[model samples]
Target: MNTLSSIDYIIFVLYFVLVASYGYYVFKKKKAQEHDSKAFFLAEGSLTWWAIGASLIASNISAEQFIGMSGEGFFVGTAVAAYEWIAAIALIIIAVWFMPVYLKNRIFTMPQFLKTRYNDSVALIMAIFWLFLYILVNLTSILYLGATAITGLVGDATAGTPEFQNILHLIMIGLAVFALIITLGGMKVIGYTDVIQVAVLIIGGLATTYLALTIVGDKLGVGNSAIAGFKALMNDSPEHFKMILPRPAATTGTINTPLNLDIQKWVVLPGIAMYFAGQWIVNLNYWGCNQYITQRALGADLKTARTGLIFAGMLKLMMPVIVMLPGIAAFVLHKHNALPGFSGSKDGAYSAILSFLPSGLKGLSIAALTAAIVASLAGKLNSISTIFTLDIFSKYIAKEKADEKKLVITGRYTVLVASILAILFTWNDLLGIGSEGGFTFIQKYTGFISPGVFAMFLLGMFWKRTTGTAAIVGVVLGFVLAIFFNNYAVGIFGKETWLYTAYTYETLGKDGLAHATTEIPFLINMGWSFVITVATMIGISLAGPKINPKAFMTDKALLKLDNRTIAMIVITLILLSALYVKFW
Candidate 1:
C-alpha cells in the first residue's frame, strides 16, 4: 500500500516540530547584530570545524543529490556517482588551493572576489547572473523535484482529483515555508540546524539503503539479508555494478547502452573523457566557485575550513552506498517487475521504492527528503540574499557608509522576495516546464553557464593577464557557444552533432516530443566549452594587453604549499585516481 500509517504521521510531525524548534532556538540564542553583515551572513566567522563540515554537506546534499542524482543512478546506473566522488577531490582542492586565497582577501561572496580581482562590471554581471540562475534553475528545480518526491511518497500527482492536487501544493508550500523560516535566522541558525539535519540525513538515508537491498533479495525469491541480497544482485543484474560505460566505435553510428536508455543523453558513460577531463570542469565549477557551497567554508578559519573539507570528502565516499544504491535497487526491481508499485521513470525509482518502507521508517525516508530539500533551499536563499546585498545593492546603489541596519534589512527583504519568486516558478513548472526528463534535463541546461563560470574563475585566479574586457568577452562567447551546441549544433553540423566529436546517437521520435537525443555528452560538451573560453580569453589577453600572471609572482616563497595541505591534496588525488581505476 502506498500510504503512511498513524505512527508514520507522528514521526513526520515530530520531524518538523523538532527541526523548527531547534532552528528557532539557535536564532534566539545568537541574536546577531543587525548592523553587521558578517554577523548576519557568516555567523561572525566563529564557526568550528564540525559546524562548517556539517553545514557544507547540508548545503550541498540537497534535492539535487538525493532526488536528482538518485534519479540519475536509475537512469544511467552507478556511473552517475562520479558527481559525488569527483566532488570529494574537488573539496580537497578547494580547501588547499582556493580557500587560502579567499580567506586572505576576506571575500564575502564570489562576485565580491571578482570585483576585487577583475572589475565592477565583471562582478555585477556575475552577481545578476547568479541571482537569476538560483531563481530560474536552482530554486525552481529543487522545489519541483522535492515536491515531486513528496507527491510520489504521500499521494499521487496524476490522480486527477482536487484532493490530490491540494495534498501536493500543501507539501510544496510547507517545505518552502520551513526553509524560509530557517533562513530568517541567518547563517548561525542554518549552520547549527545543519548539524542535526545531517545526522537525520545519514541515518534515514542508510536505513533506506539497507531496506532496499533487503526488498530486492526478497523480490529475487532469495533470502532477506542485505549482504546476501547484494551478492544475489551481482549474480542477477551485474550490469548495475558497472561504474564505467563504453561508447560505440567511430564508424558505428549508434551506441548500445544498457537498458538502452538514450546513448547520447547518458553522458557519464563516456569512459575516459568523464574520468580524466570532463568531471574536473563540472566538479570545480560546483565545489570551488559555487557561492552557496564555498560560503560555508568562508565562515570558519582556514584550519577549521581545511579540516571540515577533509571531513566532507570522507563523508562523500559513503554516498554511493547510501544515496545511489537504493536507486539502483529500484531500477532492478522495476526492470524485473519484482515490485507491484514499480513505475519506470527517471524520478520514479526513488518514489517507487518508498512503498516498501514499513510505517515509521517511511516517515524517516520522507524526513530525509524533506531535510535534503530544506537544507538546500535555506542555503540557496541565503546566498541569493548575500550576493544581492553585498555585490549589487551596497556596491552600487547604497552610499559608502550606508546604514548596516538598512543593508541587513535589505538582505532579509531579498530573501523574502526570492523565496516568493522561487515558489511562483515552481507553480509554473507544475503547470509544465520541465515535467518530463526531471533532474537530468535541468543539468543539461546548466552546461550553458557552468563551464563559462569555471573558465572565468580558473583563469582569473591563475592568470593576471586576463583583463576585464577579455573576461567579459570570453564569458559571453561561452554562452553563445553553449547555445549553439545545445540548440543549433544540429544546424551547424548538418544533423550530426558528433561529426567533430567521437560520440554518436540516433534521434528517436518520442510521442511527438520536440527534444533531440544529444550525441555529445553534456560533460564533454562542457569541457570543450571551457577550452574554447580559455582560448578566447588568452588570445585577447596576449594580443591586446600584456600583464604579469598571478602565478608568476617574484616571491618564490609563495609557491610553497603547507605540509598538511600537501598531504591532503596527495591523498585526495590518489583516492580519486584509485576510484576511477576500480570503477573502470
Candidate 2:
C-alpha cells in the first residue's frame, strides 16, 4: 500500500538532482558576486520576464495554498478559490500601477521603500515589524503547515493525532534545514531554480488533477475516462463549485449572550465581501507590495518587471485549476463516495487525494508538493536575509559602514538565525494552535497588517500629499483594527458578528436582539479591516504635516509601458470580471 514505488523514488531522486545541481550551478555562477551586495541580493539586475514570473508563482504558492485551499474546499466548498481569484486582479493592478514606481526607486525591501518615501523612523519601525512578522507569522506558519502537508502526503501521519504532532516537529526541522541550504546559495540561485520548481509543481499538479478525474470516472463505472470522471464529480458535488457565498448565519443566540430567538447565524463564509472587498486587501498587499514575492520581480527593469508581473497574473488565473480544482475534485470523490478514504476533515482532503497517484507519478507529484514547500521557504528566508542585511544590519547595526562582502556575509548568517527562530516557533505552535483551519489561520493573522500595508502603499504611490507621520499612524491603525476585530469582536460588540463587527443595530442596548452568531470568516474580517485602515490613512494624511511629494518620485521618469503590458492587464481584467460574474 505504499504510495510511492522504487520507480517513483528514482524519479524523485532525479528531480532532486536536477533542482539541486541546477541551483548549485547558479550559486557557483554568482560566486564572483558574493562580495557585491547589489549583485548578490538582486541577481545583478539581470532577471528576465520568465524568471521573474516563475519565481513569483514559485514563491507565492506553497503548501499553505496547495494543501490549505483544497482543505477549505473539502469543508466549505470552492469558495476558497477566492484567494487565487483576488490575487489575479491584484497582480494585474500592481503591474500596471505599482511596478513602475518601485522600479524607479530601486528599493531592496518594502521597508526601504517606506523609509525613503516617508522617513527613517517609519522605515526603521517597519523593518523591525517586517522581520518580526516574517519570522513569527510568515516563516513559522509556512514551516508548520508545509511540514504538516509533507507528513500527511508522504506517510501515515494522520492529522490531529499525537503521533502526527510529534512528526510535525521533525518535519519542520527537515524542511527548515532544506530551505536554509538552498537559500544560502542566495537570490540568484533561487531566481533561476524557481523556473524548474514552478514547472514541476504545475506538471505534477496537472497530473494529479488528471489522475484524480480518471480514477473517479472509473470508480463511477465510466471506463476510466477523465472527462466522464469530471462529469460524474460535477453531478455528485455541484454545490462545491460555488464561488459566490451567501451571508453566514447560524440558528439562534449570539455567543456569550443569551436570549431565545427565532433565528441565529454565523458566517462560515462572508459572501459579497469576499469578492468585492475582503480578498482584495490580502491580494493587493501580497502581490503589490510583499517583500519576497515582489523581490522576485525586482532587479529587472520596468518593462521586464511589468511583463513578469502580468505573466505572474496569468499564472494566478490558472492556479485555481492546479490548486483549487483538486480540492473540488477531492470533494466530489470523497463527499458522497467512500473511495478516497479521507475522513471529512478540512486539511486532509489534498493528502487523501494523494492516495490515487498510482505508482510512478507519486514521486513526481510528491516532488511537486515538496517543491511548493521548499521553494516558498527558500524565498521567504532570502527575503528575511535581505531585510535584515539591508534594512537592519546596514542601517542600524553597522550604520552602512560595512562593505559589500561584510553585508553579504551578514545576509548568509541571517538565514541561519531566522530559520532557527522560525523552527522554534513552529515547535511551539505544534503543541496546539486553534482549529480555524490552515487557510483561515493564515488569513486571520495576515489581516493584522495586510490592510494597513496595502493602504499605505497604495496611497503613498498615488496621493501626493500623504505625510510620513500620517503613514506611521495609518500602519498603527491597521494593527489596532485587526486586533479588535479578531480577538475582541464579541466583547466590544456585545455579541459575535462577522463583518461590521463594531456595527450596531436599532436597539436601546447592545444585547442579543437578532440572534447568536459565530466567529467571522477571516476573509470578511480582512475586508472590514481594510476599510478602517484606508479611512484611518486618509484621515491622518489630511490632518497635518505631510512629507514633500518629491521624496517618492524626485527624478524618476514617467514609465511608458509596451503593448504586451497593456494586453496582459486587459486580459487579466477580462478574466477576473468574468469569474465573479459567472460565479456570482
Over the stretch 1-584, how does candidate 2's per-residue lDDT look in tens digits? Answer: 23567888898888888999998988887777768888767785778999999999999888787887777766656666777877877777787778878877777778888987888888887778778887877787678777876777556556667877777778788788878888888888888999999999999988988887887787777668778887787677776667765443343443334221111111435666556566778788888888878887778877788888889888887787777777777777675574455766657677778777788788888888889888999999998899889988897899549998899899999999999988877785752332446666677777788877878888888887788877888788877877777677767675444455322212112364543233445566667777877787777777755555544664345455677777877888898778777665
- How displaced is residue 194 in candidate 2, in Å? 0.3
TM-scores vs. true structure, each candidate = 0.92, 0.90
The number of the candidate with the highest TM-score is: 1
- Tell me the deviation in Å of residue 241 in model 2: 1.2
Candidate 2 segments whose C-alpha is farther than 4 A from its true place: 156-167, 250-268, 431-434, 495-517, 545-551, 554-559
Lowest summed lDDT window (length 10), candidate 1: 550-559
Which candidate tops lDDT? 1
lDDT, candidates in the order shown: 0.76, 0.75
Q: Write the per-residue lDDT of candidate 1 for residues 64-133, one digit (tens) a residue.
A: 7777777777766778787788788888878767877777667778997777777788888989888888
